[model samples]
Target: MALNNTYGARLVQQETALGAGVQILLLALLGSATGMGPAGWLTGLVFAVASWAVLSRAVHRSRLSSFGPANRVTLGRATLVGGVTALVADSFRGSPPVTLFVALTAVALVLDGVDGKVARRTGTSSALGARFDMEVDAFLILVLSVYVSAELGPWVLLIGGMRYAFVAAARVWPWLTAPLPPSTARKAVAAVQGVFLLVAASGVLPVMADAGVVAVALALLLWSFGRDVLWLWRQSRVVRQQGAGRVLESVAG
Candidate 1:
């Protein structure tokens, strides 16, 4: 067991505090340089600081560092995604904002693998870590989907919708909440969907690129969802059979 010493915590806390201060200072500088003025810059600064604080707290409370290399990578990745999203939004203006957001989003989307790979390599896999990573990925997907919807229409929801629907299904069907083994294919599909949405957002792609990518993403999502649903169904059936067997044995006794 690890000692309860605050050594590691202090190191992280110091870094996090410094980061928050830098965000505020940078936002102030940007406000002064650009006429976005005090209000916009202050608002951006507040959001940046708040987001960093919350994520730091989450990492601490969850003791995610104990989770090993892959999970550490995942944590870094999610933080990076959230940071890049906010930075891109604040830094860009006018027609080019879309292009900038697209490029960063693509990088963030691809970097998703770093954490999971580290976790698997280090053998630090845990349910909490996996769920944490999944939730972060889901939120980014939702953010991108909503942004695209303004120009691309509701069909963009398909990318985001499946995730929410799965969460809802888990709530409604307890069996669906049961954990199954992870898959590389599922992760690849997620990356595909993310790339598709970001590409569509850039508007640099041809209609065919948008349509083709979206179709592939939707297909992957369908395959993933179908596999999970089936696995859940099988688990439920096995559990029911076990229960029935116990009752029969008791009655016979």
Candidate 2:
């Protein structure tokens, strides 16, 4: 077990290094093409380091023998997300190269489904992997939201911030953390967030049309979250009722 744990830690360290290296290379290339500034580099560095820290901690806690193929795919996706984040941050200082930003985000979104399939095929799925995948997706949406919000108005941020807000709620309402049954509709809603945001960021559509699409995305996300919250609330109520019944029976006995 100790050997296995050590191996996992080492593998995570190596992957983290590789991710950081990729981040640097991509940022350099982007700088050459688009003329990035200190803010861009700084943002990318923060994301790279943060991802590395989180992933390393997860790997340590997981204590697996290997990083696994699914994680590799996720790591690659994260690298793309870092690139997108840098581009988005840089946009605050100056106009970003639209094509590059779209390309990076598009590839990351495309690969989002691939990692799950890989995990299933390889039978390497774990809580850590799932959480890592989810956080990456959420961060990407948040970054894209920031980029799109510049044009569509700050209301678009709700689409990105909703997940984090839900997590925060879960802390106070532990019942909100209950697992939800699978729903294809929920998955579809999540998948479209990046696509819609990317389209908005592309500036290819009419302003009104872009806003309409983002509005739809936000609506679907809200519905999905609301549905889950309702389910969790019901489940919590049932649990409380059952517990009360058991207590009353014991008291009568």
Q: Which stretches of candidate 1 lie over 4 Å from their true place?
A: 1-4, 10-57, 60-76, 87-99, 121-128
For each candidate in the order shown, give its overall lDDT on alpha carbons.
Answer: 0.67, 0.90
User: TM-scores for all candidates?
Assistant: 0.75, 0.97
Question: lDDT tens string, model 1, 46-89?
Answer: 55677567757766886543435565555555544554445434
Clashing pairs in 1: 70-118, 70-119, 73-115, 74-115
RMSD of 1: 4.1
Best by TM-score: 2
TM-score, cand. 1: 0.75
Candidate 2 C-alpha lDDT tens digits along 175-207: 998889999989999999999999988889999
